[model samples]
Target: MNSHLLNGHYQILKLLNDREDGKTYLVEDVNFPDSQFIVKQLRPPSSNPQTLTILRRLFASKAATLEKLGQKNDKIQKLIAYFEENEEFYIVQEFISGNPLTDEIIQGQPLSEDQVITLLLEILEILVIVHSYGVIHRDIKPANIIRRESDKKLALVNVGTFNEAITNTVDNLEYMPIEQVNGNLKYNSDIYALGMVAIAALKGLPAKEISNLRSQKNQLTGEIVWDNKNLKVNRKLAKIINRMVRFDYRKRYQYATEVLNDLKKLINVEDDQQKQHHKKLLLVLTGVVGCIILGVGAWQLRSPKPGSDAELKLYQEGVNKYDAGNYEGAVEDFNQAIKLDPQNALAYNKRGDAYYRLGDYEQAQADSSQALLLNPQDANAYFDRGFAFSQLGKYKEAIADYNQAIKLNSKNGYAYYGRGLALAQLKDNKGAIRDFSKAIALKPRYTEAYLQRGIVRRRLKLRQAAIQDFDTVIKIDPSDAKAYYQRGLTQSINKQKYVALKDYTEAININPKYIEAYLNRGDLYSDLGDNVEATENYNTILKIDPKFIPAYIHRAIHRFSFGNYQGAIEDYTTALKLDPNNITAYNNRGNAYLELGNKKAANQDYSQAIAINPNNALAYYNRGVIRSKQKNKQGAIADFQKAAKLFQQQGEQDSYQDAQKEIAILQHNLAPAPTTRPKSNNY
Candidate 1:
């Protein structure tokens, strides 16, 4: 099937392997050659249509299992698609291009102690998820573990599903646990294999030879001794490995995380010991105070301490670079500062802030964590880490850090503001308002806090209070386009259309590139029945930034309201091209297709939207309407029930009630329900 296109997209480039079961091909997208995939084809015993149908069902069932596993772990190769074509089944998955561990672990040429530790840790990380899923990778050997070429991350491939069981273990005797050979595979079975791999590396031999070495076996138990006196390995690591490869499966680590924790502890202990040794040596060598009193002019240098002069110089340079927006340069200077004085908490805190600016939240979190370790009471370090956590979507952790910062310094307006943001994400609007109000009390002219509080009030239906917050912000800084735009939103909600139009106009005039202001102005004009002006506003936003998605969505919504269904479809289509997973565009376009009576396309769009965001109540409700039209009563009721449940969970009481009404109608009256237009493009 070379060069044959499958799924209307993937074209087979080259056959990777041909086995008794099927053939595996390296395929690339017809439109994008660089987007590569591996397609596995399953061949039946004969071309009987019934047998082929059964084979197709089996392929799809197993594919679903692999797909679910793919979503829960980043270290596992992803299952992209599974389909049937020309009476053959195809399973497409992400192609991980890398050599196996066998290439790196040459027999008789052992890896360094650190190298082996790193490999064990990386593989164990992947196994942690695999084991958590209650699945055992019966085959855990060097050849099966791929070290990714791009990032050097170990990605586990060829996972055996329940349908495609891996029963063969004759050649992998060295890596297979004894219990696994007897069909009793525990989670720690993989741990035994990994430990054997480590032992093989330490002994400078292949795992097969190490497993069968009679000389290394215990005198009575027949268990192979793992560590050797000649092997250069840490005592702690050796002990951990011994427990991992215990002859009794029950004696080994019961979980991968247990082993991971122990390995991390060993690393931490080694680091602390090295640091202590260096500190003691420095103290002995830098005792120059007595020499200076004895008139020994040769003793000119002294021991470095926290915030030493050299470190301070580098720290100041880092601060200047950070202020100038040279985050990478600031990080370099801070690295030097920390190297010169390892205990410089100020340097670490500043570096964390710089990393935050550079959009490296993980590094920012790490540096801030180190700063907190050195100076536990540092409020700024807590705030910095909290800010990083907020960006990383760890809202609860961010709130805890912000709470600590506020406890250390109650006057810190930034802490209150950050805590408010985290609370808002967690849907605690009242708590967010309280924090925002506290922030405003601490800094009366804080525009961001006022703006956020105004938005929250608007969401809570306190339009007048929200308007007042916007007014205060505008009064403080008249040139603030965002404040004027927010005020316009409140005014629009309060039915002051003309006043809202003027506010949007002022916002646009102040910031000529304000896309949201343009969209809102367009919406206001549309509400006023000024079609030409509304279209012009949306067109202006598109002209400013052709790739801006909101402009297309707003224009589509405007066209739909004016009964221009085809124009709306065109705009939604363009928006989807810019962002394939734009749930708003997909759902709205589905509505347009439904209006045009293209039920198939509409169903497809709704299904795609639901696939992208499973909690999409609107998509489910709309699909229910279609199913009702098609006289699928049971399917319609099921969809309506699911939609109602999701709507209730999402706090859309009106939509939830509508969905319940649909289900009742479908169940009793058998009448088709009206379609809903959800606030898909809320902005």
Candidate 2:
């Protein structure tokens, strides 16, 4: 507690922090006045006996490894000296002058994407060296990463050691075999700890609770919860982190070198993007120079240059109109430009964009192809051609052209976003997400990228994240009916019926012709038992799209709830007529027929429903009821027994009990009648 020497040499200056494992103190070396150091006490007597022994052994081994590691990398903090006093061991190590990464993240100043990638790659390199020496950093987390203030160089601290605060605690201890525990103190455990550290850094939260993270029901994979808003991570980097932090160890990168390789690839990608941007700028500058030369040549050759100048003016006007979203007017001006200057590649590209906007794929493709023929290096022409291909559902060709456009101009966010959409159509979710993220990196306000990324996230079952993306989309474009509709669907999946209904209603308000919204809203109403509103919405959908199967299904349910058995049967029958494999319709129709005393028709419908879906337990129950009513007591009992078994298999205890009751009733009814008729006949 004083500014005095401890254990013969370390001059204790001030206490930094203390944990269950040991205490950290700012200290100075007695041998060198200018030398500063940190003294860490390992396995203080206050720790548990078992943990003390483990730490004593671990530290003795780590000290030897650290001595060797220090010689390999100057950044590796040197263990200067060590000694023991009063049953507590202290280690003197080089004092790092910097703040912990933990403080930065906790203070709401997370590292940028570039900084994160660099830090991770450096740590991975250090880890590869440590592992090669048969040492592992069993506890890897933000607190162990130190950023030097003067050089801005990040160094991994406290390597080849466990954070006794985590592993030395006896409470809630998970016992492992001695061999496994020892193995866990080696490289495999180091990999696990590194993954946890990566996740914590990217998500700005502790990764120890990753097992409890929500996933789709029955899914073995855990969802990655990267706080991109907080960390400012690009999509590509987030993906790399996700793969690293996989809950299943087998799915994660087996070695630190593999993770480092991925980081190197990302670095290369960033470099390539920069080079492409430079090339595009050079090309644009060349185009400007060419235009100036052409202007000079025309000025020298023409006696009257009015007509040529007018053509150039009209072409510029057409480009402006196209940029302003006036596709029809842009097309008109483009025609005039072509009449004045038929060989203008810029005019052709602008006209192609206009045609693409008008949904004229053939004309768009022709004009874009012409533009490309005239100027093969034109990025805009490639983009236009890609758009046309995407419109025609030729995703492969669209992707190829988009690749070409990106090669010519990597800063073209539009091309990246378009390629993302095409990839999504092809069901390449990871690729699509990467492209969308790149688009977002280039254009922060890109609503379409957010919307498309949200859809892909939902497909990946990252529901909460998908909701956030949709929220961003709605914030950007308030009248986006599809955004509202998709958000409502996500809410419904999350089982928030009222919230889903509100979203669906908003969608309908934005675009009344959104038939899916009407149907979905009706379904939500039906789920909430608002049959009247459900029926009204269903009716609206049917009026809009007469062949809508869901509307018929909902109307049938509404009728069934209101005791309109015949009407319910008619509606269900109509739904099934439109779609023969509509199992729900068949089941509902069977129930309606059973209520209306049509036993034969009810049985047939139930059989068809069962044929469509072998797991339709309700159909079995309905058939059992029909058999009971027909006085075939033995057959009734058999059917009820089967129904009860099926219900039990499905974990429907109440339905199983109902079937059991029917079985009991049928068995009782099948008992022999009393024999008392002989006396009356004799009289």
Candidate 3:
């Protein structure tokens, strides 16, 4: 083949380089004689038509993507054309008249930290656009980067990955990451090569010599150890470089933006902070100055460190804010205090209290536990932890912590109140009432204690006494939304529907965004068969918070009740995807599936509910019915027995009897029992 005018309208000026994948050449477009272009020849090993066909398609697609990128980014080389000549694919690219970066990155001459940082910023600017398009530039070496002659701005060349050529002595392989070399190119692979280039420049090592200069290498983990201490680079910059070139791609910066952000932080923020500013005084001084120095020396020996005053001030400010009921502001002050002095137990405890007030129970528990770690005997911290546990439904743990708090400080009325709430959740109604009474006795105006005792009273079916307790709480704080909500629940249970509706409305008026109030009001409307009102309430919940899964579930139940099985199935499926372990979603979705005559899908859902929670007796019973219908007699009997045992253990007398009846039917090998109805985790 002639090197001149190899294609109909192109001429090869000179061969630029050779590699395993293909050859790149300096070429000129014969039609546009005033301009020159770079042409890349794709050399596939196999001459088979099928192999070449796939390669040609991939080549054209990559060329199109590069053209798109070049249109948006001036730094990237523009795609001129791509064509097939003699069964070989060639990509023509716009030529940049410039000096290669290899000229600046000379061996035996290390670039300074500032210079390397600047270089990184320039390269990363191009990469941000490249990576955003989900395209990985497999080749990012010094020779591939060009400092344009007209302007000093660097221009990127060879943007496609098809130029991958991994050979023992190949210069490209020096900068190519292990993942890229193995043909699994990640977005970070380009970052890794760019990092390697920076490392080589900073170490005064050539591409070939850089590989040999590894002081330590973990072959298993693929950690590359370059000398940061011996070089003049900033330690922060060095760490960034190391992270970019980690052996495992997972450990590397997953995005160009991430690496760029870290580099920017290191350059912009840490650079100025690297120096310490202080005043130096002369030793030559008068008697007064000497006395002052001696006094300061003694104070330094006895007083807290320089930053202790600031920490104490912040803690005091946090306490003041907490007293003012500004929980958010208190949290901000406590955060600063903690940052100033992490070992301050008081600050952590105060922050925990603020978090508790904000209803962040998990964070409250964490901070209170940290406070306890610093000072285990602190009764307030113990009470805080107990309160968080109670809110999170860890009733036993809450009780245990409350026990500790009471032991440490017998006058801790809040501890007793917290323990009462936990005992109420555990269904120990009498114990909860007793604890609440003790709390009220300790603090005569303990309104929360009265409120919680009311709840326990209602659980025990002491309706009049529960109402009296709620009346007392209202007397103490007439504006309490929770007190009204609890009363509404009690009235609803007593069949006072209109009264319950009024109480729910009052709660909502006091706290317009009260989710429980909205839920209960909607439920009452649903019970009354007022479809329009119920729908409005549900829609309001969704509009307020689309991620409120419980509202979707309620709407699904309403749909199922009205015979819209398909709509119910879709809603339940969405809920299940968001909360896979939700027993209500599984059981109800199974119900919807069953009504749709999809017994197979129903059986799968019931099985899943059982898998998530083995003690779910309803799920076991439902699955038993499906198995019996499918004629798996022994399997049905086994499931029924399990359901009966669990139902009996849980004190569900009616359900247990039903399960036992099913077990008898299955054991006798007679006709299957009636299908078990779905259970709900109700409002």
Candidate 4:
């Protein structure tokens, strides 16, 4: 126990901290210099060897879970290694270099409302992932949140469910909701703690002080007294925070995503600027600004807010269905709403959003365009159309529409977000980053903007910077499987194959239908010569989606590499069936048949490929070899000559030379070969 080295590997450098659950140390791997890792000594409650052994195994399993969660996200601390030594469990994890958020929060310097929103969004995003794993972080406080120095983003440390102490009384009672103290903890308990954190930061007071201040007021009242504290928060955000910390658990946000969505809405241009920024200006310059405001309202009134009661009910139902993730039901309800209220431009815009979610970009574009025609000043409609155009790969058109949306409502962060996506598609990475940064500045919790910016940064070869952006995205929405998959790709590029594999596996676990993750993992396995695993992944893709052409082609290539000629031929044939004019499929299938010594079949496939694209030099070369093997000397000579010419024209010098050699052999075989040999020896 007194040895500096643990298990003959980790050399203790310094003690980080100690708690009731475990003692943490910053350690260095004796095997890996210039590497730092966190080591925790987990002490079992019982001193019995058997109990300790059982706990070690359980701890190992938990380590795997922690590793998976960490790989799928950047905000979570990554478990690197774990082992049992001296009847005590030792867990190693990656060290994050950052200061605690508590340290960043000064007593007299409360964070701005925007900063509060950003902080809550970041924490809620991580909580969503944590809760999905059925793990409750009973300790939600500023100290647990680290302002990571690498990216200046928030990273949640020491996810609590890994330790039994989390279920006990929380170390910081000030952050604990009343229900949790009563031993009735739920997901909303975390929400309550986050709300308290927000209030504490805004009030520039300790959580205990704020709670004590609130406890003196009427507990039965539904109104939050903090709202009356004259804290600098918008009404909408205040309403959300109030609901989050409500005395009644049922009144709090039921889920982290619910809180996140409301926080995003609070920063929306329509909600923030229209209501908060211009309120006093509109009152003071009522005559001038009122007309502009009236025009905006009139555009909205094209749908008539007081329309047929039944129609309005249907529209509200559609909105509710959309919010509940029932896109198909929402579409039906929206259709009914449109039928009942034909002049509803808002209905058209909402329906367009529904279509966009369903991946029907054409229909979405049409609906959004119709809405714009009905109300030319509708920024939401323009934004919707821009999103549709971006999805359709018409980046320039999308950029134009986004420009119009931004012109109409300059404060629209989402329009900036849409424009950034289009600019990214247009190959303007710098422009895309600018717009994305702007969007993030205006809407601090804009997860998609962070994601797209990460992609652009990765494309620009800013690996660490890109990773930081992806980390922010994960911190904003942990359930985003795409973010994990993308981070896996970046890790793979960085030569962290093992870490990348864990990331891809986590992504697949989160979304079993994620074909791209499977395909990428299969490709990585194939590159590493783990053909069995690669084939299994490809098989899984086929099972999930038999019509997926890439799976068939990739599987065929894998089979061909392993000398499974017939299997490769069958897979390539399936690919050809899915895409009749697939040139690569025909050529590859022909090569597979040639490998199996089927000259006739191989010749037919080569001929089909050449017919599809006459300039295919490989097809010509392949057909020439088949003819030469068939003993058809005249046909072989003719085909070889044609192949040699085509290969030369295609700048394939080696292929051309090989074809020329075949032609000379065919000609000599057709003529009298013995006579030519004798003449060459004499010369």
The clash count for each model shown is 0, 0, 0, 0
Over 244-298, each residue of candidate 2 has an lDDT whose tens digit, in order, gives 6555556766667667767776776576456545644654566566668777422
Q: Write the per-residue lDDT of candidate 1 for residues 1-683, one digit (tens) a residue.
A: 65567889998889888877678889998888789998877665668878666666666676777787798566787899888777767778898989988787777898888888888888876776566455677667777788899998888886655223311223367777788778777878889888888877776676557556525779797677756677768877888998988889988887776787688767766764464355345433443444556665443223345557787788778866765558999999999988887876667877898899899999999999997776566677899999999999999999999999999889889899999999999989999999999999999989899999999999999999999999999765555678889999999988999999988986775556789999999988987888999999999999999999999998898898899999999999999999999988988898899889998898899899889999888888888887788888898888889999998998989889998888878778755644444334443
TM-score, every prediction: 0.51, 0.42, 0.47, 0.58
Write model 4 residue lDDT over 427-527, tens digit each, in one string: 99999999999999999988788888988999999988888888887666666778888899999999988888877986775566789999989888877
Q: Measured by TM-score, how close is model 1 to the native structure?
A: 0.51
Which lDDT tens digits does candidate 3 get at residues 130-247?
7655577777988889999998889898876455321122337778777777767788889889999898888777777866754368667658878546666666678889898887
Give the winner by TM-score: 4
* Ten residues in sequence with the least summed lDDT for candidate 4: 674-683
Identify the superior model by TM-score, candidate 2 or candidate 4. 4
Pairs that collide in candidate 4 are none
Worst 10 residues of 1 by lDDT: 162-171
Number of the candidate with higher lDDT, 1 or 3: 1
- Candidate 3 achieves a global lDDT of 0.79
lDDT scores for all predictions? 0.80, 0.72, 0.79, 0.78
RMSD of each: 22.4, 20.9, 20.4, 11.1
TM-score for candidate 2, please give it.
Answer: 0.42
